[model samples]
Target: AVALGVKFLDAQRKELPQGGAALADLVTLDMSGLDPRLGTVKIEVACDVQNLLCGPEGASAVYGPQKGANLEDISIMDSALNNFGEVLSRVANTNLLELVGGGAAGGLGAGLVGFLGAELRPGTQMILDITGADEKIKQADLVITGEGRTDFQTAYGKVPVGVAALAQKYSVPVLCISGDVEGSPDFLADLGVATCFSVAEGPTTLEEAFLKADEQLERAAWRILTVWKLAEECQLKKLRHS
Candidate 1:
């Protein structure tokens, strides 16, 4: 009877049974007030896992190195991921070592696929589907989307790109706002983004910017609305004259 139960459990693991259940935990370290390079590397690794596995690598890299890992430590973690990828190929008969988004989360992506059978899909697509953003675009007067930063990466399946595409299908103008603008803003025009704005007034340190993010966003919002109001007034005046 015990042997039968054990066999049943193995079968369940091999094939997702009715009422599928996920048994796992994702751990991330709290890395704050530490070396920024290490922190960023850790975050990049975790993001890789999240993109490849279930949801994005939410916890690990985002929080890790802040807890005290240095560049050397990050490299060690990266190596671990490479080795894990090799192991995954042997066990799963799928080589995720070279997969895009595979290097996320210190190789957490490899770990997820190798150990938990997760698959990688574009994060933007997932968000669009989940939010019914396509339908929303059809109804909206204007589409507004934003991020902490806008750069070349924004073109790579980021929220703004996804939202802009949906807005374009409805022939609606899409606007983007970001805490900082990097690279060329004109580049995003091709993505159905009509315009982009950076919140910063001028040069400021990272600490000052973060502290002022909410206030800056509020001010930007007011400015945008004010411009829209002026445009509306001009249109109304023209109609009256005509």
Candidate 2:
């Protein structure tokens, strides 16, 4: 089963089929006589593989702030994740607390691993695996990819880099476009990005940039392809002269 929400099981409150009134809420867990068909199903998730299931640096504490989780919410959620982890560990006959990438999507990563024998992997890799991206890359001469921003982090499993990696396998070049750019072209080129461009041509606020993103991207792509055609013609001319 593909679970999206991070909160696979809540411990603090009563939720349907997933939670209870307190921490360590599961007093009973029976896994015997389960369907054999489950083993045939492969489960995978897209998330960082470095996050712990619980603690200050765990999934909740680090990602909670962005989800409107205040200090109190974080404290409560962290405890809840701890309880949930304990229950999963007992049922699965293995400890999930230290499972790398277990904190992805809240604590769902750990739960899937414990419950379904799922494999937790980077988002990019999972997507490529699922979509048969390598086969598609083989059919293409070039790959263009983008994200909200291009920066140092882009080298680390970001979409552009992920796509670029696959394309690089067949020696296909990659170009990236983004809402904004925070790194130099040289840095990105070394990471296999042939060139990177921003949608915004001049100074613009975040609000304005978003409003014009579609138009800006369209124009940027046209400009890039036009330049590429010109360069191709120039190369052909040089070959003929030689």
Candidate 3:
């Protein structure tokens, strides 16, 4: 099965699927057999999201705004997704809407699952396992992870949280330093993020933040390192006195 969402559902309405059309119906799949050039292949869709299909947290409602989809467009897209989910459920003989990571990359997760019977994998852990990150995290004194933005959503299968899961196994503290930080501090802590902060030092416009990204990152890094050094020294002094 081919991936959808990232390409098919763009700002420009290229070819909107008709009402109640399964995503598979919109595309033609070659089920005759695997291509002769490639031998048996196992399909796996790795994504760092857990949003279900057809809901507020679904792809259209959550990611549409970033893709230049306005209210009218989001509403339309959501309705189309609901209809598509219903049809795919019958064809796949499975509940695509309830599939974890189904909303990923704009229904790409659902597409792969429905059409190809591909496995939905948690991308971060999968990649980290491949990259031997567990060994590196085990040896490191601290683990630093970040994303474009950290908010309530970050708690839901985001990159930083994925890193935190591995680091926590080795009793390593995880610090998240994102371009932007939102949601409550408690919520962030609950996600196993020791601490998190935005790169911006003060109020700044989106354009300004983008332009000053490098400088802002440097300043934030400096601040975090300085505080860390002080904490280390304090610990040393306390040990000496005790």
TM-score of each: 0.60, 0.63, 0.79
Root-mean-square deviation of every model: 12.9, 5.7, 5.4
**Candidates in descending TM-score order:** 3, 2, 1
lDDT of 2 at 81: 77
The lDDT leader among the candidates is: 3
- Report clashes for each candidate as comma-separated counts: 15, 1, 0
Residues 54-150 of candidate 1 have per-residue lDDT tens digits of 2123222332354576655544444444444554466557877656566454445655454445665656667787878888789987777899888
Scored against the true structure, residue 55 in model 1 reaches a CA lDDT of 18
In terms of lDDT, which candidate is stronger, 1 or 2? 2
- Kindly indicate the candidate among 1 and 3 with the higher lDDT: 3
Which 10-residue window of candidate 3 scores lowest in summed lDDT? 1-10
